[model samples]
Target: MVAALLAAVSVAADPATTASAGEQGAWFSDPVVVSGQNTAEPGIEVAPDGRLYVNAPAGLLADLPGAASFLWRSDDGGATWVLTPPGLRAAFPGGGDSDVAVDPQGATVYFSDLWVGSSTAAVSDDRGNSWFASPLSGVVIHDRQWLATSGGGVVYLAYNQIPAGVMVSKSVDGGRTFVVHSLAASVLDRSGCVCPPGTMVVEEGTGPAGLADRVGVVYATSTGGVGFARSVDGGLTFAQVTVAPARDGIDTTRAFPVVANAGPGQLVAVWQEVVEGQRTRVQFSGSADWGRSWSDPQVVVDAGTPLFPWVDANGGGKVGVSLYHTDQATLPDAAPDDAVWFERYLESLDGGQTFSPLVTVDPTPVKTGPICTQGAACAQDRELLDFQAVAIDTDGLALLTWARSIDNVADTEIRFARQLTDEATTAAPTLHLHDAVGDAITRPLPWLFRTATWSPTGR
Candidate 1:
């Protein structure tokens, strides 16, 4: 099935001819500005029809003060965007974090917002022209509600309500109602900062894990390192599987799990953790038989500390992970106020076996600050909401969005970038030194002999 899908629209890049130099250098489009200022916690969704929706809790200059959330809609991919009215805040008092999801069948858009201690969502059937907002029935989602929609319009939301365990909710009738299920009995600590929220997805078909048509969820636990749950019978019943065992007496909030279905039955999950008391690293695990079991966790990237790791998988065997790594050599000073942070992305074409070198998405470190200012000096803190977002289209183009300070640390703004999955073209190949090893290294070179061309999958 994966082969069939890839073969259907696969393009054989011209073998690096002299005339193909410019096209070969076009592996990725230049950074496209998604929003100008005053927005954080950017949640983006790309519809099957090529529409783009980005949502944030607050800070959008276009939105009123009481407006709970701000939305930006783009019809021609991400080239141009317009603000959707601030109706979401009218539904919830005092804004919190929010995320967006879309139903492919009807182009129905679902936007979930956390506010005033409860999680609520809005639905848009006619793209972003209009919306219907309401509170989720089954659970009072306390933290970030990461929503995922199945092809059949089945919406799954995963959240963490401290002292009540991590929960997964299902909404079959669009975003109108929900059925919540508890995957864990208790969180690591009700008082500790909210453990990073869990992530959920409905398998496309029989998953690589051998579980056909199952709804799977992966979450971070205070007591347990990482937990997995799946409902083979839709959203009715669920059983747990151990992905990563808990570290004795260690806080698990540092380990936020992000899961995605790569292809037919293939699953990939990534997160971050504080290991050996001082070092922090991004951990990855995969399941080929659904959520029943998982492979041993492995470190994918490590700097001084990696945070807010986000993961997404393409229908082909490609997986992309994005996170920011900061170098903090001293304790207590762990969250460096003047640190040079690398907003990096790593890609894997053959599942998780190997990953491309860290790809810096931001032109410069967050330390470079803002290019413009909106309000008072932006608070010098690790802020970008909970996590950034990444999505891949049928054409194998990866769209990534994140919030960053505009001028050093003056204002917040949302940024977007595109990367080609099949291959990244370059006028010519480049070189790099071996890390500490003297031998030069060059493998998996996609641009050496080929250039990527577009072929609509008609997905």
Candidate 2:
């Protein structure tokens, strides 16, 4: 039965396409500005009811006393957005890194606010109108915090704990309270850099019987490698797996690896590494049996210097990866140049086996020069922060949020872009079924359809 299912959804015949020099006829709608003030390091999520939510640190708003992160909601997709009321202070008042996640049933929305030495998690049931905030108790000094949710009121918060390592806290009673679930990484794994962990995802256990839902996270290890931690029994315990071994040119400070679930027991990891000639490329690897093993790393984009890569997957083998790309090959400390940077996206219909032609989400340059990698220490060109986010909605349309620097120094704003075409229809049909023997199975049907295009206004 397993062999039959694999044959039905095989994507080996689909050839990979090269990155095109021209845009694909407005494949992505014009980016809509989502923030009125300067904000960086944006994160986005789509609730089950199709409501969109974006969160970021209160950049200029932080100057005001008792100010927290910013939250924006959109009912009419990405066409327009409304900012929530200001001064929703968390436990720490001083807002830093921000992340947002919604429960599987869309009954609750979770948001994280990271301050200098600690962090807080907020929950909202009636959208963003009201929120109840609680301080995360497991970690004493939290650097960056990310949220992930699954069925049964399960929520996982992953973050770096000062000089220790990566820690994950679980909240089974909605987001009211949380306790340390497990240590994703140890002090030995972190070496000395308290690098932030990538996005966290809860993979529904739709495989054989007795298999429970799994929570997975990826982060940069001290040995210059990518580490993946998986918890099969909810967030009770996690076993770390080395997705990619130590490499010579990997910059541990900024080498944040992101993981996404394409299907049951199927995971993909994407990160950035410097090549032989000092050119940085986005690399990805795939695992069919959860995080037990991973395929050799493959280049997703090598034409330009890519930074802050993010990945998200849906359906059978459909995956989307987004990153900031620039043609100039300059060092991080190089002076500001005329080089232009844009946000680029690539999709895969067959899991991570192959990818389609690169699509520029926005033609406008987000930044004009070198981006400072030194956190909070760089004196210039640090407006656009470290990471951006990408989410595949229920309709399989990609939604992206990132910070754009207008002056390349301090003036920054949050912007959003959405895929205009219905890429989900073009892929094979995904079906989850139970075998005759009673074990669960997931596979794609032998059928395909032409791509359909739509505009944001029509939706």
Candidate 3:
């Protein structure tokens, strides 16, 4: 006997919010302050139980002592947040960038930073209540250290391998020990230093039997292009694939690639670049059957110069990309004036075939200025060190987070906005029924069936 009760969902445009549905289907929320105490290079993640975690460089030059990092947690989603107690201080005296990730169960949280001579991490197993610090076993992590945790507690850390290539350190037993895997490109040019952080996603290992669990990482190579590396047997070894060919305008300021696993064997990656004769724009491509192949690149956002594009995907083929955009000059021209910079977003409900309209995320305007550090390069770039982040909750809400320089760069604050659209509303898990085995079953449609293997007797 099969009996299921699922709520009927509908679609309508929400006019009061920027996440309104239109020609391309969009949903954007108002900006809210996660923290006002000088946050930089923010990283955001959502727990399985609806908790939100954000970590970043705590403050500017005047906020603290000995290069500190800040941790913030929200029990009520992103509606509110509080700074985690006992902040982490750098083992060394310098700070460049940091990233954070939570275990699949949300029982453990990990934060990474450049230590005295290598990349180190601060771990909290008690849901950010406390912490302990340690190095990444044997590898030397560069300035931008990124962290990602698999459902089975495998921790993967990716960073630049000095002169060339990207190295990933994997730990199967909750980061106790690591096996480093190198993914070097033959065309890696070291003459110019441009090492962007590599973004990784652990494939959902719930597919058919005999399918090797995969972990994918995407980053920009020294050549002005994006490279993808996949590991089939955990993180022991990796095979590389070029998502986009090398171009002429691949600089640290313009080339940031973000990647995500949409579903079983479905992967998507996005990055920003300038063609030799075209304007700067964001290009996207994906692979339905893992990284064995990928679709051609297509422009997703090109209103102005879309800087630092970041992408994230959910289990149901929903992908989100966020970036700091500016309406500057096109390629082959001098750097355009640093006009007002704003945050923008793009989403694809059906993998990478189509995307929603270019939606403006933050309503506030950000102004850039010359670097205040004496003797620094004469580049008038905005202080956005890294890229923004987008994470989808189980309920299909997209939470976009970033550090916005407000009040004329005098104080940078961590900010975020929530976006919800008709697609998300219809996909909401409003009603769930249990099967004969007492496992919760969520049926989006009468014909679409999904199962959770839970035992009522005991584990």
Candidate 4:
């Protein structure tokens, strides 16, 4: 039955909440905004029916006219979102970062973006209301990363071939047909200049089959280091490397590198480093031989770096990381620091060899500019680029979404918290119930029976 449910949870999926059993450092509980509409620049994913597939970036920026961009959906899992009314657009003119995946058993629901000069692609399978501006054969689908789904139809697209760096694409018969492959060059140093938006994953049992589908890729290199790739099928082929490996001191600050394999072979990542004097910490890494090797970093959150981690092992893996903390040396232009912020620590135990001291899925401190535009570089030059992601359902609950800058632009509209599933009675229980038997219920787990088919054994 789908490889027996992906080989029995394959990896990462055991945390009935109740802090899974509490005491990893428990404190999680405070985050709830869900849907959004302050105006343009939104992109989130996580929808097969579990809901939370937002995509509102109404971007009228240079397109002048107005309202043309859309794709808003939030069916409760995201708290309260609804605007499929007449959005979803990308004839090109700023409507970036929108990658959603859902085809584990076939109702079909996938979305992708990246239309700058125009390789022309604005696909959607009815989940976002509507969209279809295809042209991927035009051969220009750079830095894309959706990775997953070997369930039978095939859908694995790990991209980044711009200027020349990173590649792995496959649609099998599912994503509509694709098969691009070009991996390893020490794993991308490709002339340099990446970092517009790059985050990939794939490398557990290795995708398409065996249920270990994880193909990871992260780019933001001035060389600050963050570019790796691995495709266990699904994406077809890949095996690149270049890790900044060496946590504790944290160091990365170029901020933006979040990977997730959760199981199969275990590979979790986090990024945000600017450690010359220390303050931009948010470092965590792992690779159970998938990327060859890694492990020896843990700084959780301090200067913060826009991290988002999720793993609920029905087999044994549970973690959720999200940290922002930015005023950038005192309002380096106020950036995304509208002020009232805090999603802190968050812990649900069961998957930790090093970092595990979180528990604030939503304690609500809230504050960080909602500026949708001022100079816009993901808003005043990347302060953490408005949330964009954090998902986990099937009974674990911890869906997060963010984007509310103050002066940089895109204001008060995209917000979500979820963190449901509790049971910690008290010791300090103001609201720290990371769930153990805390039940909030969010069912939807399929596609893992070791991954369902397609293996090469890392050759």
Candidate 2 wrongly placed segments (more than 4 Å): 1-22, 60-65, 86-92, 190-193, 204-212, 332-336, 422-453, 457-459
Stretches of model 3 off by over 4 angstroms after superposition: 1-26, 59-66, 86-94, 136-138, 179-194, 204-212, 247-253, 327-338, 368-380, 421-459
| CA lDDT of every candidate | 0.61, 0.71, 0.60, 0.45
Give the top-scoring candidate (lDDT): 2
TM-score of 2: 0.85
Clashes (candidate 1): 19
Per-residue lDDT for 111-149 in model 2, tens only? 777765666677888788878876554577877788887
Off by over 4 Å in 1: 1-27, 59-66, 179-185, 188-196, 204-213, 248-252, 327-338, 368-380, 407-410, 420-443, 447-459
Decoy 1 TM-score against native: 0.78
True lDDT of residue 280, candidate 2: 74
Candidate 3, residues 17-118, lDDT tens digits: the string is 223212222245456688887655677887766678887764332232345477788886676788886444344222445677888765788776554245
Give the Å shift of residue 336 in candidate 4: 12
Writing each residue's lDDT as its tens digit, candidate 4 over 15-44 gives: 232122223222323344544455423445
TM-score of 4: 0.28
Q: What is the C-alpha RMSD of each candidate to the true structure, in Å?
A: 7.8, 7.0, 10.3, 21.3
Give per-residue lDDT, candidate 1, residue 34: 76
Candidate 4 segments whose C-alpha is farther than 4 A from its true place: 1-41, 44-98, 101-109, 112-154, 157-171, 176-198, 201-216, 219-227, 231-240, 243-248, 251-255, 258-271, 281-402, 405-411, 414-459
Candidate 3 displacement at residue 19 in angstroms: 15
lDDT string, candidate 1, 1-459, tens digits: 233212211112222221122322234445567777576757677787888788877632223334457678887667667877655436444356677888877688887766535666778787867877775533663666677777565677777665476566767677777754545324542223345456777764434322244777777765537777777766566777777887774444553578888875667888877655555567777777667777777666654456667888876777788776554532212554565654566666656654554556665554432111111233444355456777776665667778776664447777766664444455544433232224544444453433554322212
What's model 4's lDDT at 284?
59
